[model samples]
Structure formats: C-alpha cells, structure tokens
Target: MNYFIFGGSGFIGTHLINYLKENKAGSKIYNLDIIENTHNGKSIFINCDVKSEINLNIPVSENDIIFNFAAIHVTPGHPDYDYFETNIKGAENITAFAEKFNVKKILFTSSIAPYGASEEMKMETTTPMPNTPYGISKLVAEKTHMIWQAKKNQQRQLTILRPGVVFGKGENGNFTRLYWSIKRHRFFYPGRKDTIKASIYVKELVRFMVFRIENKNIDIEIFNCTYEPAFTIEEISNSMMEITGMQRKIYKIPAGILKIAAGIIGAFGGKSIGIHPDRVKKLMISTNVSGKKMKTSGYNFHYTFDQALDDWFKDNNKEYLS
Candidate 1:
C-alpha cells in the first residue's frame, strides 16, 4: 500500500510513522512536511508545505491513503489569522487535492477543541461551540474534507478524528508538560487535580488510525479517538509519580483567581492571552471523550493513560525526551 501523509515530523505524525513502519510493513509511506527529515528508512520526507504540495503533482494515486495531520498549533499565544490560514487553508488544499488525485481514503486529524471547553465527557455527536479561532478552524477543516468527499462520491472516503489532548513519549502535549513540571516541582492544578481533562497517548491514536485504515469496511466512522476511559489531571499526575517515583505538592487555587490573573496578563499583553481567555479555562474544565466509535470500528486503545506514560519511557535512548 502507498500511504501519503502530511506532517510526519511532529508529535502525532511521527507516532503515525512509527505505526506504519512497525505494523504496516512492506508498505511505502510518503511523509510530506515543511521541515527537513525527521525519520529514517522506508519513508521519504518531502520538504514542502502542505498548502504548496496541494497541486497533486506528488505521487498520490487512487489506491493510496492520504492523511492530513498538518496545522499551525501554538496554544496560549498563536495569532488568530495564522491559525485560520494554516488550519483552514491547509485543510482546503489537502481536501481539494485529495479529490483531484482520487485518493481512496482521507483521514483528517482534528481536535476536541471544536467541542469547546466542557465540564463533562464529550461525544462525537455532541454540539460544538468552539471557544477559540483554533477550535473554529479545526471544525472548518473537518467540514472541508466532508464537502470534498461528497463531491468526489465513491472515489474517496473521509474519516475525521477528534482526539483529546494527545500525549506520547517526549511529547510537548499535556502529559509531558505535566511530567517536566512535576520533575521541576512546579506542576500545580489550579482548580482541582481531579478535573477530568481528556487525553490520548500518541501511540494509541496512531493505533486507532491504523486500525481504521486496515478495516475501512465499517460504517459510522467519525470517532472521538481518545483512550476509552478519561484521565483526570490528578490521576495523570499520580500516574506520573508512580512511573518516575516522582512526587510534588499540588496546589489548587480557585478558578476565579486564575481568571483574574489571566485578565491582568491580557491587559498587559493582548496577544499573550491565548486564542481565547478560556483556553486555560477549557483545560481546567472536564472534557473527557469516549472512544466508542473507535472501539466499535475494531480499534482498541493499547494503553491506559497510566500504562502509556510508564511503559514507553523505559526506552530512554529514544529522542522523545528532546
């Protein structure tokens, strides 16, 4: 099988490459990213922006699977316009080219951001009230894929995946952030450590995506691709402690106080505030996502938040720590 993927150098993309190499052997995977090479063997890196490569000049065929996993994601301070152009325009070009190239399946990695800041576990069917331009752009990107797929009809299939905060070995995502902070003893849970923050490990996410690719016969395909049971920041913190034998005092300040503090920061630096005031607000709130669709679609999560954190780090030689 020929699989063409965009953004294989970063967190999610790299994990997907690992999956393809380890599990999808004998398959040729083309990784398209703007940066220079980040992987080795059986894969070729295309040092071109996803938007630029949308010309369908690359070797995409009707038999190939195209995955769009590229985006300009910078939380807490990314400009709204850059977020829109990269996330929205990137999606537009990818989907358009997928149509033109007659790609068999297009898998788009979106975010739980589209579901807004939630106080409960969100389902795939839940109504989305995107809190930030990033969230709005992600939702728009997912729609663009659908629109293109409909136009191309049977020739193309589109699968949209909304994974919770994705974590992996050496990831800058929530898990590693908490780990590093805990290692430094600066990690604190502002509201409550027990707030159910939705997350999935990178390996598990790639596993689910691979599961989908191998078994596309299933219908009802949109998935909230996180670990089945959600993990609270407290649970995650505790898990980290178990893994690293690390411990730190966790402080819980009132959410109101944090809001006031953020307001002060916003006054001093508007752009420094984040995509929205509630970016942190959303994280503090419970936003667990169930992987019911992924499970029913023959995909299963390989790690609990605890297991995913503990087991992978044993390979200390790996560069995920960097």
Candidate 2:
C-alpha cells in the first residue's frame, strides 16, 4: 500500500497528499519535490529534481504505487523549452525508474491540453493536436507509456490521466484569478453565456487516484480525470459573484475587439503590463473535457464547481486578491 507522489506540494498534488493523509491508509507515503514540501509533513519528503538523469535518492519497493504529478504547468511567462524539460523529461525519468525498480503501478497526471480540442466534446478517441509546448510534452510522455509498461523487465501497469483545470486550496492560477476578479466586482460575461469551461475540483482527482489504488482489477489504461457534466464558464462565474457578494459592470467587450486588443498588447510585449501574451491566448478559447472513460473506469463524480468553491474559498481571498 505504499505510495509515492511527485510535486506533492503543488496545487493539485497538495490536495491529493492531504487526502492521503486524512485517509491514513496504513501505507508509507513519499513525496519528491525540488523545493521540499514541508507545508504539511505527513509524508516522507525528498528534495530532488525529476529532470535529473538519475533519481538515486528515494527507494522504490515492488508493491509501491507511483503517482507522477510533477510538471512545470506552463503559463505565459515560461520559456517554451522549460516545459519540455520539466514535463516530458520528468515523466521519462519516473517511468524509467519505475521500470528499473519493479514498481507495480505508475499513475501519471497529464493534461487535457494535449488534445486541444475546440468547443466540440472531446472523447478518448479524439486525435490530439497539441498547440503549446506544455501540451506537446504531455502528449509525448503519454505516447511513450505503452512501450515502458510492456517491457519484459517490468511489472508496472501505466495509468495515464489527463485532467482539466483543478482548483482547491492551494490553487493560484486561473481559478484564483477569476475568483478575485469577480470578488473585486470586475466580472465580465461575454454575451456568449453558453461557452462551457471544463474543470475538476481537486478532491475529485484525489478520490479518483485512491479508488484506482484500491481497485486493481482493471487493466491499466489512460482516463480523463474530470467531472462528468462540465460546468459552463458563466455558471462558475455567477457562483463566485453570488458567494462573494460582488457585482460588476458586465460587458460583452466584443470578441473581435478583445482579439485586437490582445494582439496589440502582445505585439508590444504585454509582459510589461503583467500579462503574458500566451496567457491572453488561453482566455480567448474554450476547453471542454469529457470524463466518460474515467466514469466507466470506476470514478464517481464528487464536487460541482460551486460546491467546490464554497469549501475552499474562505478568507484567503485577501492574500491572493491583494
């Protein structure tokens, strides 16, 4: 029942680690993060980079379950190459280690970004066309899993999970940004209120992982880690507004005008204005994910976006908003 988690202190991993601790599943838990995640000290912590050619620090046992959750998680500010090294090479290192160490199962957390499907409801059979470096790295890592897992020297079952935006207590990205924007009464609803933004609450992801560990009857395969019915962007936004008691002037800000503004700001180096052009690119598109396979794989849905926000969004808005 041993478990090893990479990037255990991050937004997604933090919640998962906490879930493991609360369960106290009678197994040793280990986390390998470069910065040393002592924020919560339940697990054995080792500060080491997954990109290192050799991971000689931690010991892996035959019954150990490894969850590869480490990654750069790209944003507008990152150098493109950094994403490949951190995401792809990192996964390779873990997969290689699992292969050599005779680990039983390796569950890798990839991103739905690799598929990069538009408004269409993407399925497991969708042809992935990754547009960004982060997306490419994840897809490349996923494409190579079958080879490593099938090696004659290994007894590992590789389970790859591609999840959408995961938010909960340590989230400092898009969710927080949007929450604060709405909290400040600066919320905007582009007239197209129907555009859904696919996402999963953090605890839902943890529940999925733990369930997989407990049920080893199924064959190892990739599953999309997300809620069954995706939440619309406006639905989520309105929830935030209602909970925070804030109201802002809502404007449609014409899509074409916003695109032009984004282009101008990007062309002139939006970094000075604290906006990375790539981040701007992220806002203009919609990413809706499907969890049919994951659902069929035995994970039941847990948190709706609003219900999830209510649990995590307490007074922390002060620190993040300021």
Candidate 3:
C-alpha cells in the first residue's frame, strides 16, 4: 500500500501527495523529485532527479507502488531535445528502479499530447500520432515502461493515465491563467469558441488513480483520464464568467493574428509575456481526447466544468486567482 511519487513537487503530484496523506492511508509515502515538495509536511522527501544517471536511494518493496509523474511537460517551455532527454530518460530510469527494487506496480501520468492535436475523439486504442517532441517523448516513455513490464512477464501491473490539462487549486497552467483573466474581466475567446479542450480536476485524477490501483489487474491498462464530456472553450469561459459574476466582453481574435502576435512577442526573448507561438498554436487546436476507458471502468467524475470552477473558487480564493 506504500506509494512512491516521482515529480511530487508539480501540480498533479502535489495534489496526489496531499490526497494520500489526508485519506490517512496507513502507509508511508515517499516523494522523489528534483525540488522538494513543501506542501505536505508529513510525506518523506528525497531529492532525486529522474533524468540523472544515479538511481533513486529510497527503499522499495514488492508491495510498493511507483508513480512516475516526472517529465519536461510544458510544450512551449523546453527545447526539443530537452523533452526527449528528460521524459524518455526519466521513464527509463524509473522503470529500471522498479525492476531493480522489485516494485509491484508502476503508474505513469502521461499527457494527452501523445495522441497529437486532433479534432476527432481520440481513445486509448487510437494509434498515437505524436507531432511534437514532447508528444513523441511521452509515447516512447510509455513504450519504455511497457518493455520493463514485459520483462516481468507482464506480471507487474502497469497503469498509464493520459490526462489532459489537469487543473485545481495550485495549477498555474491554462486553467489558472484563464481564471485570472476572467476574474480581471479581461478574458477572451481566442479563435473558435467551440473547440473542445479536454481537462480533468486534479483531485478527480488522483482519486481515479487510487481507485485503479486499489482494484488493479495484472495486465497493462492505459486510460485516457479527463472528464466525461470535454468542455468547449465557450463552455469554460462562460462557466468562469458565471461563477465569478463577471460578464467580461469576449473578444474574438483571429487565429492568425494571435499567432503573429505571439511570434513577435516570443522573438524578443525578454521576460515572458505569458504568450508564446507554441501556446498560441495550441489554443487553436482541439484536444478532444476520450475518457471511454475510465468511464467504462464504472468511475463517475464528480466535477463538471462549472462545478470544478465553483470548488476551486470556494477552496482557493485570492491567492490562486491573483
């Protein structure tokens, strides 16, 4: 019942650590990451980089579960090589640790980017058509873990969750940025408002992971983890506006104009204006990945777009918004 979470300092990992501790799960939880996760005081912390050549120093048992959430995930943030180096190597090292330490299961939180930017509904069975370096690296990382699982005759369970834009209290990504924009009455619907942006609440994602782990089967299971019906940009913006009681004017900026603006701003290389060409391009595409597997597994998502926003606003106030 023990848990070892790699990349525990990041948003999703931080939430998972707190969830495990709050539930009073009667087992020690070890965190391995490049930086110390100070959010949870009870969990044991081990400063270890997954990309480093050195193996992790934490003790592991056959009953222990290793969750690999470590990766260079920010699409516009890292160089192409950095993505491959960190994600692929991180996977290799983590799986190697599992093999060496005889850990019973490895749960990896991969991104929906592996399926590439698609307007169509992408299921777990869909062939991965990764276009970006980050996408390709994640796909390779999945393969690397699968190879390790095969070494154990597929007896050691592997659960890979491909989550999309997971958001909650500490999130600083798209959701957080959008939240502030709406709060300030400055948010706009870029390009088409109908484009679906798949996402999950961080708490729900963590809960689903725990549910899967507790009822784990020996065979490998890959689930596309997000809310049942992915929210469109309009839906998200409307929810934000309604929840915050701010009826901000929704500007309809053209996609090409946004791209050019992002390009010009990104070229300067000064302090980030929070808009990059990659991020702009991402906004135009539909990340409508399907969560059929998780839904079919009989797990009910507790939050919709509006409910999640309400919970976030209630639980986290000025700090997260500002």
lDDT of 2 by residue, 100-167 (tens): 78777878888888887477788777889888787898898886666677674234577788888777
lDDT leaderboard ranking: 3, 1, 2
What lDDT tens digits, residue by residue, belong to model 3 across residues 1-322?
Answer: 6889999888888888988998856888888888987974757888888887646555668899888999998867788999999999999999888888788798998889889887989999999999999999999999999998888855789999999888888788888878776666545556788989988888899999888887758878899988777889888888777876676778888878877877887789621746677777777889998877788898877777678778877776623442
Write the residue-wise lDDT of candidate 1 on 223-318 in tens digits.
Answer: 887666777778878777777776577778787877677667667774331413555575577877777667677555577766777666765543
Candidate 3, residue 28: Cα displacement in angstroms equals: 0.5
Backbone Cα, N, C clashes tallied per candidate: 1, 0, 0
lDDT score, residue 28, model 2? 77
Pick by TM-score: 2 or 3, better one: 3
TM-score of 1: 0.88
- The global C-alpha lDDT for each of the candidates, from Candidate 1 onward, is 0.74, 0.73, 0.83
Q: Which regions in candidate 3 have their CA more than 4 angstroms from the true location? A: 53-58, 268-271, 318-322
Residue 27 lDDT, candidate 2, scale 0-100: 78
Best by lDDT: 3
Predictions: Cα RMSD each: 3.2, 2.8, 1.9
Residue 252 displacement in candidate 2 (angstroms):
1.3
